[model samples]
Target: MDPTAVGRSGAVILRPMRVDDVAEAERLSALAFAVLEGNSDLTRPPERAAAWQVRTAHLVSRDGAGCWVADADGTMVGFATSLRREGLWILATYAVHPSWQARGIGRALLDAAAHHGRGALRRMVGATTDPKALRRYRSAGLDLHPTMVLEGTVGATAMELPLHVRDGRPSDHEWMDSLDRGLRGAGRGEDHTLLSALHPLRVIDRPHRRGYAYLAPDSTVELLAASDRRTATDLLTDALSGAVGADVRQAHVTAANQWAIDVGMAAGLSLRAQGYLCLAGMKPPSPYLHHRALL
Candidate 1:
């Protein structure tokens, strides 16, 4: 589809994200958050910028059709990226340059995502700490769920179960997809592929059930999917132990999942920050850890 005007005036246009827009999107993302947090940095640090680029590239490459950018006149002012997995639609990232705030750009981009995700029993999810953004999400019909960011040094905890942990392989795609579908209520095939390629995908196999986690480059656990509290805690402990040398490890824990929070605390992780998971449509009843931007 061609880039089309989404604003009331013809000056503002909305279009699919291209490879060239990655850097600006990253900068805008950082700037938007900095402004919301009352920080001085206009752009994120080098490591954060690089990580954001990687995530943006992953989303754009896998689901570019649902990614939209807002341009005011000839300048890019905002963008929104969404990914579809099974019946779930995730608003991976949405940002508007601080200078362009208060305009209808954000709403326009959100409307574009809503339009693209029309069919199916899709549940849309996103995370944000910004009150204005949360208000916008609510205006767009999403209900908010509280969440917390947990971070700390990895503890010396060990699991004595008869489970085996191994690096995920290409041949394990079907098994991983099925496990994800059963736990998350959606099959994130492309997301798993992209994340597995960029990060260390660890699979935990047990007699009763299986679990998985993605170890991000920053030594944080991106996603931890498991059937029950025991499996989830085991996977989390494994991920945390892998970050032994790192100063700290982080994970996004949902307030609804008290067991996960307890596990994180038991593993020596402390509360770092808090946010909300804005969701629309049917909610999934599973224990899973996710990145704030991509949840």
Candidate 2:
């Protein structure tokens, strides 16, 4: 059992996470990820922490019961946050303080959080390449679909970006949700609100093809979903073209989205296999790039 888990063993107690725990949990998550993802090119810790704080607060507000924290005395040592949108349940983030690893705390935290997905029609998460994490998700019965990432300084491209996309507003919610359902099997619901808080929304709404993408401050494609590959490809072109000369990246892109690969290559971004989007009861969605935490 996790000490401080179940409210038990050692000096730690496990309990449902609250909004107040966001700050400390954010610190622990950053520490854990720094060790897990040693990528020298990752966003600076301060920027990453700020983003983590926003997303963590959003998850806690939307799904308090799905979030759990392991308290070692009064300090948060391990935690997990999750979200459910209808039949889709996803692990938002999970972490244990570096000093506290290998003590079964991570497993306990995960088991407590995974309970939130018990009745979902499908479960998925965009996971890092950590082998232990990989094994854990595999043990939970999700098939692993390795994902690729496009990252580097924005370079010149001859790719024709013939399609155009416009900024999206609240009025487009219904249309976006409907497209999400058709492609991803479930509507994004409140996740859009969270994304809106951190980035700008651009949508392609044509009769033959349609799609939406959230452009991050760093020029990364935060999340994108489209009715077809061409529309998605077009959206990427427009998004990247608009961000030339800035560093950019896109992650959680599976082989199903070859258009993304082709576009990234054409834009002069280097591609590499990075992580896995673990899934159960669904195939990889094409022409879509999942949110880092909200897949």
Model 2, 69-124: lDDT tens per residue? 98887889999999888888899998888788877777777777877777788888
Q: What is the C-alpha lDDT of each candidate?
A: 0.72, 0.82
Compared with the true structure, what per-residue lDDT tens digits does model 1 show for residues 143-208? Answer: 877777777665666423325767778777777678777755577776666677667887777778
Report the lDDT of model 1 for residue 186: 75
Model 2 misplaced stretches (Cα beyond 4 Å): 1-9, 39-47
TM-score of each: 0.88, 0.93
Worst 10 residues of 2 by lDDT: 1-10
Q: What is the lDDT of candidate 2?
A: 0.82
Prediction RMSDs, each to the true structure: 2.7, 2.6
Clashes counted in candidate 1 amount to 0
